[model samples]
Target: MGIVIIGSLNMDMVVRTSRAPEAGETLFGQAFALSPGGKGANQAAAAARLGAEVTMIGRVGKDGFGRELLEVMRQEGVHTDYIGQSETQATGVASIVVDEEGENRIIVVPGANLEMGREDIAALEPVIRQAEMVVMQLETDLSMCEQAASMAHSHGIPVILNPAPARVLTDELLQHVAYLTPNETEAGILAGMAVNSIADAEQAARLLLQKGVENIIVTLGSKGALIVNHAGSRHIPGFPVQAVDTVAAGDSFNGALAYQLTSGKTLTEAVRFANAVGALAVGKQGAIPSLPQLAEVEQFLKESARP
Candidate 1:
């Protein structure tokens, strides 16, 4: 079975700088690049490259960017048959700034990505049903995410919701998500608390569980991730690597986790794989360009494995 990703697709405009500018301040950039991105598209491409048959379902514009976006997915072997092109809006975009430390700041313009809704979901129902897992993010309309999650959960299929670009979530939405992957910042926002430590993340994860989330994984940057469920909590350490651009690390993690999970890896095993994927992603620049292929991930794991 394959993975179905229903979310946003965007062209990433990236600039490399020593540091981000402050309010009313200007700084010169060292370099600039453009690549295929968007949480949905990044995750889809990541999964596809890691050997998952991926079907991407979302809206793009009938513009040059849209065509380029579709072509990129095709090259990565992601199924674009269900992707819709909007006649009225331009394709989505993300303006990203990466500092010398590999930290990033991003501003996203949803554009046609916001066009996904119940109608698009209805049209893509068969694809969703056939998928072993459904992945989503907050870039598109929340209702669309909810609808997709609901539909997949109803069919007994697993739904993995990456609550990125954080926002308040409903209990109804949490109820349907089998796996809730939120970074520390997003987990903090959803849990109504400040997540500055692993303990804080565990508290937030507990809160999400109360909200009906079955399993919660709070990604902790360099500290790794905290996986929480009714069974208990365990801290999965991150893989260390030279940082380049962290833009796609989280997306890569989500995609790799979904791929591993759907392929029958246990939760802990899947997360370790995701951590490797994230570490590799940050070692390179650009978005989809940074995602590691299956062989790359396998080799990375082999080299990084402990004796």
Candidate 2:
């Protein structure tokens, strides 16, 4: 079964600095690069590169960036029949700064992404109906996200919501999600409790599970990821690597998880595979371009084999 991604596509402009800037301090950046990115596009590319058939549903502008973004997705083998072009706005854009420690701060200008509506989602009903898993992110319109979740749920397809750029999700929405993947901060927001350790992560996941989600995964950066289901919880440690730019690690993890899930792997097994994919992602630079392919991930896993 294929994976469907409904989210944003943007031209990402990133700069690397020695440290993040203070409230009003100016910091010197060591390098910069422009890449094709957006949470949806990134995850789609990641899954596609790992051998999953991915269909992307989103909107872009009738601009150069929009054209290039579509071309990039096509090159990555992502099905873009549902992606549309908006005449009223430009494609989305993100300005990101990565500090020496691999932490990032970003500001996104959602152009055509915001233009996506119920009509756009309705057009993808056929595609969503055939998919085994539908992955969504918070970068697009909340209404669109909710609609996609609802549509996928109606089809009995599993919906995975990566609550990045964390926002409040209603109980109705949570009830439709098969899995909720969040970072520590997002876990705290959703759980309404502090998530400072693996124990806390378990508690937070349980809290979300009680809200109707079947499972929850809390990503703890270097501490790896915490996977929680009715069975129990486990901490999947991250692969050791020197991170360069961590811009797409989370996206990679989500994509990898969807791929494994659609392949019929158990949730715990998928989390392990995603943890490895995410660790490999941090060892590279840039988004889209840095996403590891199936072979690359295999090689990394082979070399990092444990006793």
The best candidate in terms of lDDT = 1
Please, what is the TM-score per model?
0.98, 0.97
Model 2 spans with C-alpha error above 4 angstroms:
none
How much lDDT does each candidate structure score? 0.93, 0.91
lDDT of 1 by residue, 118-170 (tens): 87797777888888999999999998889889999999889999999999999
**What stretches of model 1 exceed 4 Å from their correct place?**
none
In candidate 1, how many Å is residue 300 off? 1.5
Best by TM-score: 1
